[model samples]
Target chain A: MTDIRADIHAQTGASEPGFGDYVTLLKPRVMSLVVFTALVGLLVAPVALHPIEALAAVIFIALGAGASGALNMWWDADIDQVMRRTARRPIPAGKVEPGEALGLGLALSGIAVIMLGLATNLLAAGLLAFTIFFYAVIYSMWLKRATPQNIVIGGAAGAFPPMIGWAAVTGSVGIEAWLMFALIFMWTPPHFWALALFMKEDYSNARVPMLTVTHGRRSTRRHILAYTVLLVPVALAAGFTSIGGPVYLAAALVMNALFLHGAWAIWRRDEARAEADGYRTEKQVFRLSLYYLFVHFSALLVEAALRGTGAYALVGIAG
Target chain B: MSTRTTPLRPTHELHKRRFSRNLGVGLTLVAFIALVFGLTIAKVQGGGTLQAYDHTFRPALLPQDD
Candidate 1:
């Protein structure tokens, strides 16, 4: 890492991240969630969008999410350098200047909002703009350094993709859209806190004061289990919505059971045993959490297909 | 000669220009959103009125039963 940093310094008199480096600045994993949730929103909304417009809107929203990621990297560069998990990120690696990242983020934000408005409706475009600002300014700048409850609040930034997607199609928000947002919002804490349980040292090293750092590992573990308990019902409830079906219900049921079991095991394990387990339990839980989300969303698309084929009826029972 | 620190004139002007530019852009964004909202309201209201008239007068417009 040091050699790479030295090479970067030798090549450029000043650290100016290149185009590819800028692309890396937009964390691709986070971008994937934005893309997936937004796709689900577009797919399940009652209002049908023309294919071209839908495609354009989704792409622009993804770009807007990416803009937020870049802004986050720019702002967090200092602390990111200290975090082992984030030290290799472009800005932290000294390949990019903070100002450059800020500029890129702002430019992309403008392009995305304008393009989405042109391709779809102004309502969706406005929502996308707000989402970008919410993440870049509200969550990244304000919430992160100020409080350990950062992830809980900042999680909303990640939840906006589906809302933006729904707005793109319907040009309005609804209960169903909020339900989807709620699912992701509730799921974020458990997913992140589990990782934090196993990697407490990283947070300590970075001085970021993550939940595990502020509280104890046991508290973080209990929080993970608690959130997982809450997550299961929400995940399953989504299955009964207008967009859900037998396939999704089944997937949610099985995935949530497995997730709950994993969280339970993590919470119950002895500290020495957990350390001896070599992050296996937490890693497995994290991986399962990834699949859990994808499967649920995929099931929604499957249900849509079934309805389109006249194989199944779309129905919403009274709540 | 005595060295004295004075505020940079160009820097002050740059900040002022930036401030004005941001203000203009922000206002433009707000106006655009308001216009769009107005248009959406108009479309929905027009659609509703049209639907109501169509439903109410459909029988009158049809050929009479013998």
Candidate 2:
């Protein structure tokens, strides 16, 4: 079916990108994060879905995430063309047309939401739909270019996967779900700000009003530290919830301590000093931030395992 | 002076490179389709896999006194 006309590149003055390029547009790495977090949500929820149903829910959630990624790429292709880091992305690189990405995103969004509903419940599906629109339309199209707080408000989109996962099983949200949401929501500013610290030039050149670009690296650093303080408490609190056990609590305590130390180091460094030090502190924090969510969720799984073996009793025994 | 010709050389090299690339693409595409299919089928068949945590901690496990 990949005939000449089906290519759609020659007539549009665009190049025919390979399959890999289209996959790249989906932001598989980000989707992986979504899948993991949503898995945690589903697992930690009060109810237990069937094994196959749980897997299907996570897959649909991931598809929703990928759909959001495609739409974000489509909308941001213009700005992406101007940013050095993003210039090589499929849509901006002319490997994939923006329209193709848009269509793929819309199709996946519908499929994911519908399938999630069929497999699970309306609440989970509705939440997934909201997450897609929040990321694609509200966050990417409107907030990203309009304000420095874009990531702050838009962080909700990334935070929704776990909630959606929880709802998939329990068919509702509770404090635990929101706690998971808070953990990611608070973590986002500092996580992306660390990248902004090093990639400020890219944002500036692209004319995107990132906090670092608009308010200066110093202000961004301050914000990172502040958010880190907020995140640590929220993340640690999640450890005390019904889903949490000794394993998760210990992990959260240690991980959050390390995260704070790293954030502090970033705040203390002068730009030139940081440059000379190769931004190692920020880079390390960024890497750890990636692991932070995964480890926390995995620790919850550990808690579940313990509960299974009758090793540890539920802490709250309520909620 | 240089009359030696390895008869299988060109075909062997072509096959090696082509096979690897084809294998890579084929594996990736299959994995993607399988993931989607597995999820869809799982959804249709029985809802979803129990989360590791869920299987470990069932609702029945709650204290009977409550």
Best by lDDT: 2
Task: Please give the RMSD to the true structure for each candidate, in Å.
Answer: 10.9, 8.1
Tens-place lDDT digits, model 2, residues B1-66: 565543434344334445654776799669767766766666445423333433443555454784
Candidate 2 lDDT over A1-319, as tens digits, reads: 2344333334544454556676788899999899989998888777798786788889889999999999999999889999998899988788787899999899889989998998789999999999999999999989999999999999999999999999999998999999999999999999999999987589998889999989998998899999999898899888778888678889999899989998998888889988897888889999988888788889988877677656553454333
The number of the candidate with the highest TM-score is 2
Expressed as tens digits, the lDDT of each residue in B1-66 for candidate 1 is: 775554335344334544654666577579656645554444444443234433443444455689
Q: Kindly give the stretch of ten consecutive residues in candidate 1 chain A with the minimal lDDT sum.
A: A1-10
DockQ of each: 0.03, 0.10
C-alpha lDDT of residue A61 in model 2: 96
Docking class of 1: incorrect
lDDT of 1 at A8: 38
In angstroms, the error of model 2 at A257 is: 0.9
- For model 2, what is the error of residue A142's alpha carbon versus the real structure, in angstroms, after optimal superposition? 0.8
Q: Top model by DockQ, which number?
A: 2
Q: Could you tell me the lDDT of residue B62 within candidate 1?
A: 54
Q: What lDDT is obtained when candidate 2 is compared to the true structure?
A: 0.85
Task: Give the per-residue lDDT digits (tens) of candidate 1, residues A91-126.
Answer: 888777788889989998998899888777898899
